[model samples]
Target: MDLGLRDATVVVAGGGRGMGLAAARCFADEGARIAVFARTRTDLDKAVDDLHGRGSPDAVGIVVDVRDATQVERAFAELADRWGGLNVLVNAVGPDVRGTVESLTDDQWRTAFDDGVLGIVHTVRSALPLLRRADWARIVNFSASSTQRQTVSLAAYTAAKAAVTSISKNLSLQLAPDEILVNVVSPGSVASDSLLAWARSVGVDSEDPYALMAAITEHFGHPAHLPRVGLPEEVGPVVAFLGSRRNSYMTGANVNVDGGTDFT
Candidate 1:
């Protein structure tokens, strides 16, 4: 499918690596003008170069920490100036803040909320004007499946993602008049670099994400429907489609990309 994304301007938050990078590559493959935002200059540049090689030669990377509203605003300004306008804003940035509620401190809980919820808010607010300029605009935010399912040791993280889902639902109604759609993609057991790093840290040396998921399930007592875990590429195109012109009449919906796992 064309997805009608050719020449469309898109800014992906946390596109430096992992699932964000995967989504950016998918968009660029559909011929979108991509600009990736991240804190690390090296990762951002590398992702941009990879996107160009995939198809979007004009793909660029911007260094900006979404936690800092000022930096996000400036980065969006630069993106709008370069592209003339924006169509899709995908906030795929979220740090892993995992711990049992009783074990988590106030600062730890705050970090989870800040990364999962406030970061998306900052990006969406900063890009609203640019998105409004387009004939149709889309916002795709990330929420973990644990928000709906039970994932032990991730109480704070799940809580924060639940907030993201709520924000997307509300924004969908508020932005409907502008023809801007806001939706959430709740993923489970994605094989992202972040997830892999966590797995390795826990002494799981396997390359497969399902291995990580298995370890998680065994340790946390949460069962997955699928026998295996999903890869970044598995979730990337789904996000690209949601943020593309191809997706019409779907907003404020929390679409689960969790391999048919429904612990509810």
Candidate 2:
């Protein structure tokens, strides 16, 4: 339960909101030194304060768009100067592009790849040196459950997430020699604020998270065995554990944090 994360240096690329912030909270509660990256300065400031309140000895929030390699590099440079090394890198950024393959435009596809795939690439590329300098290193990248399950109208999003999963697998193998464990966390529909807004936009006005998920399953066709959608808080501990020093041998694996899915 300790997770061996006290004083560990961690970078959460999308740690300003939703699931990313939730995962960062887990590390914060474990007393880690956390650096959170996100574009919105307000959200980053709020997250840093919250992390500090949650027990992080040191927490800094950086305003950086992961889609821009230069911004990402600069963010990591600052992290390097402050922490000297990184023990864990958690990439929680993902594009929200969703549509049928035919309905999605070329620009939308490019946006998906740029935000979901290249964003991760930028962070990982910039963080490698810092990770390598640490005594123990881990990378936990976010992927979507739709990638492993049969889902509808998520071609672009799924494609981008699939690339993230593949990249993590490859990184796991390549970094094995350095003892840097890499893994993926695939989450099903969670009742985040955006998801709640989406549900309301579609007239699925249900306050209950489980009932809301039922409506989503009935309308949107993404079903899980648990009947209810997972929560941001629910996914956080799994990510924290995977990125912790205790997770020594689990690498190149996609851990689905969905309520329950048949795929794996």
Candidate 3:
């Protein structure tokens, strides 16, 4: 299905790798002019090259930490200068920390909140003006399945993501008058660098990341319906749809791309 994203100007925070990069590639494939934002210049450059290879001639990468409102504003300003206006905003920046309530420190909680909750707040606030200027605008927020099914060691992370979910719902109501749709996309376990690091930290073997992930999932995350873990690409298309003009009637909704993990 054509997402009606051709020539649309899109901004994807944390688009250097993982699910963010996957979504960026999907949008670009549909002929969207993409601006991928990340903190590391090297990662941003690599992501830009990858996007260009995926047929995004107008794709560009900017170095911006979503934790900083000023950086987010600067990035959006640059995007506006380059693309004229924004049609889609994907908030994908998040910290990879995981800890149980007893094991988590105050600093860890603050850091996770800053990255997961405040980051979305900063990005959306900076992008609102440009989004309002577009003929059709969509906001897709990346959340985790943990928000629905509380995990043993993800108390802080889940709380932060829950805050993001609330923010998305509120923003959907606030932006509805301007015809901007805001929604949340919650993804299940995916094979990414962050996941690999998490597994290693938990004493899971790092030599074979997928094997470790499989073992962990079987013990903790195995759902009743799906027999395998989800892929970043699998989640990306859903996010692209939520951020596309094709999604006209959906707003303030939480769509789970969790391989049928019964999140209710």
Alpha-carbon error at 263 in model 1, in Å? Answer: 5.6
Task: Return the TM-score for each candidate structure.
Answer: 0.95, 0.97, 0.93
lDDT of 2 by residue, 128-232 (tens): 999999999999999988798745678998999999999999999999999999999998888777688888887876477888888878887777888788889
lDDT per residue as tens, model 3, 68-180: 99998888888778767799999888876778999999999999999998999999998988998889999999888888787887889889988988999999999898889
Pairs of colliding residues, candidate 3: none
Position 41, candidate 1: lDDT = 95
Which pairs clash in the backbone of model 1? none
Question: What residue runs in model 3 are displaced by over 4 Å at the alpha carbon?
Answer: 200-213, 218-224
lDDT of 1 by residue, 1-264 (tens): 789999889899988888899999999999899999999999988998899897799998888989999998899888877877799999998868878989999999999888888999999998999999888899999988888776668899899999999999999999998889999888888777767777888898659666777887777666567767788888899899999999998999898887777544
Better of 1 and 2 by TM-score: 2
Whole-model alpha-carbon lDDT for candidate 3: 0.86
lDDT of 1 at 221: 61
Best by TM-score: 2
What does the lDDT read for residue 21 in candidate 2?
97
